[model samples]
Structure formats: C-alpha cells, structure tokens
Target: MVGTSEDLHRLFSFYWFLEAESRNTRSREWAEYFTLIRTQIDLFTMDKFDEELVTQSREAARSKPLKFWSRYRISGGALA
Candidate 1:
C-alpha cells in the first residue's frame, strides 16, 4: 500500500530487507524486481503523481521483466 512518499519508501525498505535475506537466485531476482518498482515509485512520487500517475505506476510495474510478485500490488495504505 502507498498513500504518500513515506509509505512507498517503507514498502521499498521491506523489499530491501527481502533482497538482503534472499538465499537463492530466484528470491534475489524478485528483490531486484521490486527494487526497480520501488525506484519507479520514487520517481513517480517526485514527479507529483496523482491518480493518473498511480495508474501508470501500476501499469509500469506490471510490465516489468520479472513477474515474481505479480500477485502483489500497491494500494492506498502502508505496510505498517
């Protein structure tokens, strides 16, 4: 979930932890995938993303090369 820049950053931070904890190539791959998505999030936010950007962001992530986290999606909330 992501309501603001901080929220998105938190999600990315979790992904960072996942990347660090990964033990296999697949897990690591997913980590890099999420990292890219996170980078997009950061850029999208910096660009002042509104509803339109939100849609674009999701779509962009959907098109990523790796789809390990296809089931996961960013929404209007925070990780915790």
Candidate 2:
C-alpha cells in the first residue's frame, strides 16, 4: 500500500508540474486531469487517517468553487 501510494503521489506531482508549466495553453485539460488524479491520491492518502483530516478535506473542497471558465460547457452557436 505504501508503494502504491508513493507511485500515485509521483503521478500527481508530474501532472501538477504539467499544469503549472502549461498554464497559458491547454491548461484546463491539464487542470482537470490533475484534479482527477489528485482525487485518487487524496482518497488513498486519507483512507486510513482520522476523521478530522476527512473533514478538513471536505472543507477545503467547499471553499474552492469552480471558476466560470473552468466550468465544463459545450461551445456552439445556435442555428438560425
């Protein structure tokens, strides 16, 4: 379990670096991908931890509402 956690952590680190470095171009995709991977890491890391940690995690998530641009939306003009 420790090794698996470490590997996931490394993947999260790599994706985070990619997101930070490519903030100007294709950042949303990278950011969303990072978020997905981060979720896995957070779940694994906190699975055996205390309830306070879980509560803190939920609080942190609640504090950050997705931005306008970050909201997933399809782009297309209406037919005339």
Clash totals for all candidate models: 0, 0
lDDT tens digits, residue span 47-79, model 1: 665666455544444344133343333331233
> What C-alpha lDDT do the candidate models reach, one value each?
0.48, 0.45
Native-to-model Cα distance after best TM-score fit, residue 58 in candidate 1, in Å: 18
Candidate 1: residue 10 lDDT (0-100): 45
Listed per candidate, the RMSD to the true structure in angstroms reads 12.1, 11.8
Winner by TM-score: 2
Locate the minimum summed-lDDT window of 10 residues in model 2. Answer: 71-80
Q: Cα miss at 73, model 2 (Å)?
A: 28
User: Model 1 misses residue 66 by how many Å?
Assistant: 26
What lDDT tens digits, residue by residue, belong to model 2 across residues 41-68?
5675567545465455444433432332
Among residues 3 or more apart in sequence or in different chains, the pairs in candidate 2 whose N, CA or C atoms overlap within 3 Å are none
Q: What's the lDDT of the predicted structure labeled candidate 1?
A: 0.48
State the displacement of the C-alpha of residue 24, model 2, in Å, after optimal TM-score superposition.
5.1
